[model samples]
Target: MTEQNVRRRGGGKRKRQRGRGEQAMVPDAEFTSYYGRPVVKASPWQADIPAYLFLGGLAGGSSLLAAGADLAGLPRQRRSARLVASGAIAGSLFALIHDLGRPARFHHMLRVAKVTSPMSVGTWILSAYGPFNALATGGELLGLMPDPVRRSRPGRMLGVAGRPGGIVAALIAPAVASYTAVLLTDTATPSWHAAKRELPFVFVGSAAAASGGMGLVAGPLDESGPARNMAVGGAVLELGASRIMQHSMGIAAEPLRQGTAGTLHTAATALTATGALGAVAVRRSRIASALSGLALTAGSACTRFAMFHAGQASAHDPRYTVVPQRERRDRESSPT
Candidate 1:
């Protein structure tokens, strides 16, 4: 055969093969079977995690606030601070125990401390702080250590011992506020993992604001001033951090901005703002302080719920996983 004829035949055969392949290929829409499914399972973390987080933050922050008030020579503030601190500590312990799959195994968490694990660090912090806070508050409540200067050496020693623990707890409070975010961000939850930076700040601010609000409601006006300021500052930081979290993240931010999360976030924002404003006006009227404090507490709770919902939403959605994985694949395949 001639070269031209041979070329023609080969081209025709190639075209025919291409057509057959096209006809054999099935469209993705035609197959409605469950072929491609998500690989990772959604975390079954219950409400207890966030509740424990909030209580832990509150306990840590309140302890610091109480210590600060004590140092300031505000007896009423100190008493209120100690009471709140003790309550928060107890509540946190309860929540932590409740959340554990094996509540009895919780003691094993303190067998040894690991700096690499937030949970381990948290366990140690609680172990050390919980008992000390309980003892200090108990002493004050029972009037066993009253007038330490005039009391026996043991009473004076107890007061001295309490100071160091209080100081230690105060130092650890910021970490308690922020580390919960780290714990969540380190997880597979898309919304939380994507918000690694802002989440810590948000939690910290929320903790501070919540604790301060509690103190303001419980303490006298003069002593509550610093707590009020802390609350205001925390609210401002939280609002800003939340805005940044929503803006910086793309689709991942949807959980926080829409549906149930949106409602909670909105309520949190409004309550926090109202509480901050009320804090300023609280100096004029005790009633305003009480009302604002309540608002802030409610706001803090809403914020925690919103954060938890956002994480769950992110985990439940397939787009969050698929989009990131697809982008990563595309980047890897691209030429340098």
Candidate 2:
């Protein structure tokens, strides 16, 4: 697997020259496969894959929002963000488990932590994330709301518990938000592997936009200043990054701009742009803010699905892998 000798070079077979003189420099590594098929297998993940990524990112954003609100003494924003984070993260866990074919297999993965595996590391991060979210959100809930048991010690403790609990969740939020991009890039999928440098930023931006949208939709206008700012900033970030790749990857970026993936991405970009603008214009109106937020949330979800399908599309086409390598090799061999 380490070496792929040339099949034919002009009229003669190639030789591997090593450490003797100025070695041949290639822009991209070369490889071959049976019958022009992919050298590596495509992922067997179902529809749940993108769904899981979407929720994982939403949870991460909410966790950060919660912690920031707490630190700034914005209790309402803090409480709501934490609660949303807990529920979203819990949902993400369900989706991840379902993808494993057998749900209990997830526990087996947890028995031994391996840093080498992104999946394992993500699980560990979630283990910490879930409990912190629970403590932060649940604690605040019982304290603030009318509970069946009046004057309970647990209820009394919950109010104060949210502060530190939220901090812990915040610490791991960005990792939870961005690691899925790394997981995808680590695979053999050409679209994913090629866009590794930009995908994480795209993902984080989506996450932030989504989290901010949820806050704006659910929380009061007076308390959601951070949410509004985040929504606009994140939409801009995601759109700009995706747009840059049009020229960056050349032919390889076509999968992101054509077929079903292209349609979905286009819709996402338009909706996010509209939402970003509307968020500023209608900042004072709760109804308008809610509408903008809803649009943003839908757009972010579509973006996740688009990226997921794009990777699958790239893997199915052989030219994506072969042609890029050939072009890179040719370019490298040419004079400066």
- Per-residue C-alpha lDDT of model 2 across residues 46-65, encoded as one tens digit per residue: 88989999999999998898
Tens-place lDDT digits, model 1, residues 93-140: 787788786877789887888999978887876777777777567546
- Model 2 lDDT-worst window of ten: 1-10
Best by lDDT: 2
Clashing pairs in 2: none
How close is every model to the real structure, measured as TM-score? Answer: 0.84, 0.86
- For model 2, the stretches where C-alpha displacement exceeds 4 angstroms are 1-40, 147-150
Question: What is the model-wide C-alpha lDDT for candidate 2?
Answer: 0.83
Query: How does residue 186 of candidate 2 score in lDDT?
Result: 78
lDDT value, candidate 1, whole model: 0.77
